[model samples]
Target: MRFVWRWRRNPLRRRSDVVEAWAGVAAVVLMLVLGTAAGWAVGSFAHGALREAVRQQQQHRHLVSAEVVRSVTGTPAEPDHESTTGREGYGRFLARWQDPDGVEHTGLVALHQAPGPADRFPLWTDDEGRIAGRPMDRATAVVHAVLAGAAAAAGAAGLVEGVRRVVVWRLVHRRYAQWDREWQQAGHTWGRADAGS
Candidate 1:
């Protein structure tokens, strides 16, 4: 692994040793710079795109008051019941809301509390008065971007390390085979006046 001695005056240093040393340094430097740059670029682009989407949703989506038409109960079966907000949720209920343009829409709504007939609840609507989920927020967008960037960096690092290992291992094998060939050539001719060093 020590390459400094290879460049110095040495009887045992082979050309392959110098090549391996330089290649190792180059590979490490390149991986660091390229991987980090790629990760940052991907992260920044993703963040900008996601933030724009959130902005559009916030601008167009509106909260309208709706009246529950049917009583809905029972917790829905969820594969992942874990809630990040640490709050329990109520079931869905049928509700109707009138849009700003005077068009009315009805859909299933999830509420924190049980809803009876004529109970008022807040409903999210898109620009065309269609029922929609809650609008995306800036915080969620940033979190997603950060996670994506980290994943990119990790993936790049893993791939680079795997390739480096394979190359180094092959180089070691080749060096050993070269040593064996040299030994076989000089095995029976050592210390002879005709077999010169």
Candidate 2:
């Protein structure tokens, strides 16, 4: 209790201490803001690159006639097949085809349409292999990246703020200690005068 009173009376415990503490807090806040922006930029660039790669692969794809070896139902159905077959489920078809080099390849194809047990279907394949469809557009990929980046930034900001508050509290406590010591020395000198009287 006496220590609290002495600290309150000390002139060295100035308002500037509060200002400096707030300044440190502001610096940390600024770092979090900048980090978030940088993270978003990086994520956006990566997503755009991925989408472009998909688009290029789709553009180079070639169409070929394939024989359906078998047909199987898929879970959660294909959207295109839903309207035609009046069934809301996905379908898978096993197909075999000869490439331009006359090499036979067998793979599974997911169709939006229901096929009979042994129906023929047009298959599309790129130089490397078959793909579901064209790559996603850049705008869609960017939106997803931005959202993910922002979420990460928000989490980081929370951690930084917590650490900054603890540091500031410790600094404030140190300043209070110094002020208390100065006041106690002054009080001791005054007490000696009262004793002599």
Top-scoring candidate (lDDT): 1
Instruction: Give candidate 1 misplaced runs (Cα > 4 Å).
Output: 1-14, 72-90, 183-197
TM-score of each: 0.71, 0.50
Per-residue alpha-carbon lDDT of candidate 1 for residues 84-147, written as tens digits (9 for 90 to 100): 2224666667778998787988766666777679989777788887776688999999999988
The residue pairs that clash in candidate 2, if any, are 77-89, 77-90, 78-90, 81-112
* TM-score quality measure for candidate 2: 0.50
TM-score of 1: 0.71
Report the lDDT of model 1 for residue 132.
68
Model 2, span 16-83: residue lDDT tens? 46555565657577666866776676677767776777678557766677787887554344454212
RMSD (Å) of each candidate, 1 decimal: 4.8, 8.5
Residue range with the least summed lDDT across 10 consecutive positions in model 1: 77-86
Report the C-alpha displacement of residue 195, candidate 2, in angstroms. Answer: 9.8
